[model samples]
Target chain A: MVHRISLVGETFVFQDLKHILASASLLRSGDELAGIAARDPVERVAAREVLANLPLRHFLTEAIVPYETDEVTRLIMDSHDEAAFTPISHMTVGQFRDWLLSYAADTSSLEKLSPGLTPEMVAAVSKLMRNQDLVSVGRKMRVVSAFRNTQGLPARLGSRLQPNHPTDDPDGISAALLDGLLLGAGDAVLGINPASDHIGRGMDILWRFDDIRQRFDMPVQSCLLTHVTNTITMIEKGAPVDLVFQSIAGSEQANSGFGISLGILSEAWQAARELNRGTVGTNVMYFETGQGSALSSGTHHGVDQQTMEVRAYAVARVYSPLLVNTVVGFIGPEYLYDGKQIIRAGLEDHFCGKLLGLPMGCDVCYTNHAETDQDDMDTLMMLLTAAGVNFLIAVPGGDDVMLSYQSLSYHDILTLRSVFGVRPAPEFEAWLERMALVDGTRLRMNQPYALPNFRAGS
Target chain B: MSQLAQDPWGPLRRYTHARIGLPRTGDSIAGSEVRALQAAHACARRAVHACLDPAKLAVGDSFIEVRSQAKDRSEFVRRPDLGRRLDGPSIALLKQIAPAGPWDVVLVAADGLSAVAVERQAPPLQNAVRAALAHTWRIAPLVVAHNARVALGDEIGALLGVRCVVMMIGERPGLSVSDSLSLYMTWNPHVGRQDSERNCISNIHARGLSTGEGCHKLCWLLKSARKLGYTGVALKDESTNMTLLPETKTP
Candidate 1:
């Protein structure tokens, strides 16, 4: 009786099997592995040589070895120096794919693979995947856990507080914050664009929010949405800087308009890290971007708005920011003319940012001069909610008096939560529950919520 | 890294209202500079929303207060076209108040973007121009249009049947200066005139081009526009060595 070997059911076949065999010094006389043209002959010779040189336990029974199988397996095994690879090296690509799919189907398996796999490896393997496979891999890697357990890229929402009073008074700002919190907004972060660009005023606002959070034991974090340099000053001055915020543009020139470069952003990030005020781990940066900013600043590099926007995402990824929002319709009529254009841009930005492994959010907003209204925002917000966006801007009454534009209001947040059955971040939800701002799944809007005891004058 | 490092751009900042040479703490701008910018921003927003009190304008009893097609400030901001025409009552009032003749110029004051600019700078600017052209030009009665845009002046001038119209309106608020008035002079002022047919003199705030200097520039531009038979790109200001007055900062 003659024993025969066949090459089938292999997940990965090493193309330079002969070279690997040579490197391993595992060849026998009269092998002539390279000249063997016949498929069956090649498989029989390769498998016999590999089986003779390596222990039987090295090869999985389900897989068929077609190349310098032992040498390839050895390389994969040794690759575990950086990250453990013992469990994955013997498995073929098909087997690994099945295992990943099964793990994704049950997130409990996330820890099982966490110790052995790197984000880079997952990113590399993601290229060969399609649809659900890619999505499953992305879902596992996107949630940055530096800030309290975000639980890997779950949908969240936040608001921009334009507590802009005619007079830059603290009482008015505190009122706005209380109003939004009562309405169950600011889950993502409490970001403020101060009416005065003065550092002292910025510091004052930061301190006020910090005091509010401490007094009320609120789970939310705060940021003064000003120039990076100004924010750096606030941080140095012992202000409670949770997230250092800046407006980022795709081109260098536009960033220069905001007085920022990658270096400046890194500096701000370092400052925030040093301050370490956020309850959520040290991922402390908030960035806002618009499409036409680059073109308006004369630094677009002739790229289309969408491409430029994605490039901005690349920049955001470098810092691993806690919040990255794109102010879709806020730029003006020239770039994203109407509701249709604005909606498409918002969806595209969200999709690209998510695809690039960033926690993405949309500003579902429009300027007063834009040929759009609340209905347009409604459509975009619904679509973004369905798309599993991380957050949306929650302004008072959906109108930003300082920016002179309309944005997603506190009411919009309630609508989204009710319609989508989504809640705020875990910590925020717990805080809201404890404060009785929410009853079960519903926001307690009709009930009177207690104001924080910290008075501005006091 | 010295605390005594002299600001390199401090002297240049005195020359312009543009945010320049703001103090830096490390690589970032100082809190004082940031505060100044924020203050400017607040001023600008206030300027935009400020009410235009026609009574406070004090242009004279001969000037009649009128409304544009825009019913309110919100509507004026949303539908700019509505703000460019006179409302029915305003048209009737203009017809009733002004004598229909070939007046040399119709001076119209509008609260465009900044009511503070209209309230603070318009009266002084109008007075200077009026004084400069006292004996030469036959000026029509001033018309103060509420919730009005620049082109509204064209309709008012056409109703008064003037050859030229000088519209002293509020310029858009800048982060540096909010109470800035602008003069838009149009030759052969009438309905259906494009913005290209008008000449603009902007930054006429107390700090910028003063009422006197703006008045001189307007007089020169208006006289040239009248002579050249056009006001826009074809006309230019030829006033020599025009000295800017000391900037009077507005609160």
Candidate 2:
């Protein structure tokens, strides 16, 4: 159907829903690169004007990537709840935005409405929203997921202790891991991005991490960020697997680019569940997603990157992941351009993920080549925490040597926790007190701190 | 550097390059840490925006210079499509350099995201790769294009009618690493190739993968891509650190 709108004297024509979604998005480099962005600023508002009147049910009727060819699309359609959508069925995209920001969409209401919302519906409403609107609505939605620790609870912030090393050195990882723990940074998990996918190397890292996790009796889970297939093999070999990690995408084709499928993911999810590693809850999947991944893989099927990003949450929602985050600014200037765009993208991803019933986090990072810096990350971090995101990835001094990208530092996370008056996961916070790293959200002063001890074995 | 100039874990930080256990003031890092990051950002800005010093690279008549459609650094950074194809005059120049050829591979050295990487590392990597693959492949003269991306190699190779393209370009700079380089090899080089249709060897720098090792891997991939008649998913990097291993003395 031809979607058209007029602004002043100009008449704007859009090809379809996908085209309108791309045009209606705020300025970002990825949409422009896809050649689907509005020709000018006014045309963008015009596209949004047309999109505003679109009935909420239009997203359910017109599949963005097509339902037949894509498994992610199939999963979304198959899992949607007609009963839950009835409350907002009559609202247009504009009306839906007002509804989300109004008093009617409370904590329980959003939770019940989550299953009925498709990525497209949330994405459309999000594009109509301002940053404060995103924050106001996103902050109200509480999506608590648990493995060994509860995350995304009200008045709490979670963090992943990313102890990534260039050579998968145990001593190096241990050093960073110790640094993270002292700053109260690993409430979500102590995750490592191993340099290589060698199975022996993966199992070695896992065992070393498990040793620290066990000796401290820390409530935190541990993961080696390798491919899911490698983790599955390690699981078979009796390695202490806590979370099965993979970089997932919105499109089935792009997931294949990562060499994953719903079938493979199901197998890994069930396998991890069978191990019964969690002391608190049973969510066993950890996923990292980013905008432009599908486009980067050349399999976006003409959908905008923002919509593509939301679709990935659909895939993540099916598995009930303990944690899900977008490596937002790490995709670089081609996708996000600069600090302003990166900040907006981070908030949007958080809002969309929260709305779709997933525990969302943001890496809040940028490459040196990108025209952004620590100041921008500071803004985004404060925004995400205010929006009540589940977690943030904290590494040593915000520099990931293995990945070679800058993210939030342990100190930065501490600052955020201090400013927001939010604590770590309840169980992990108890462990922090037990270890005497902190005296009720304050770092223990002048106390002789004992760092972690690694058993002398690989 | 005023108070707590010394980190308690300073000795253990040698285990990794990651900056750990920074001195803290309340919940924030001290001034020196902030200054260090600013210094890195400045270095990286120079790496990305500074003009290439091709003279420092020591190229001769065998190397031809060209420009992508992107006229400047800002446009090049923003418009990737412009960086992936050569300008009209540049295409004419490439055609003039080699009117027609059945070369095995064409080597392209592009000043991608970081021109500093190309200025510092390209000469060593390009020379080593050419010398190593001289026997097995009929390689073309190095094509140095400014304001270019990895896909720029495709159009250059297609115009030269080469079977494969080995692209040595600057990777996006990390905070502490502004000059790390990367190499991408693609078979049947063309204008619109998916990233999956290539094999990438990244993180080549002073502290990362060495030029010698990068050359070895590229040569191996070239040979494998020829045997398999493809480059991307079907072919795998079965490379190891055998070159760095201590040579067993043959008694």
* Candidate 2 residue-wise lDDT, B43-162, digit = tens: 888899977767867786667788999999988988888999899999998888775566899887888989888887788877787777778888887888899999898898888888
- Candidate 1 chain A least-lDDT 10 residues: A25-34
Among all candidates shown, the one with the greatest lDDT: 2
Give model 1 RMSD, 1 decimal.
20.5
TM-score for chain B of all predictions: 0.84, 0.90
TM-score of the A chain in candidate 1?
A: 0.69
TM-score of chain A of 2: 0.98
TM-score of each: 0.54, 0.91
lDDT of 1 at B240: 62
True contacts kept of 2: 0.78
| Clash count (model 1, backbone only) | 11
lDDT of 1 by residue, A345-368 (tens): 776666556655567777898754
Candidate 1 structure quality by residue, lDDT tens digits, B1-251: 45334543333223322232233343233667556545655677677667788787775576878888878765666456678889998898878766655578878889988888989988777776677787899977777888888999888887877888888888766555678788899987788898878898887876577777778788888778777888887676677645533322332
What docking grade does candidate 2 earn? medium
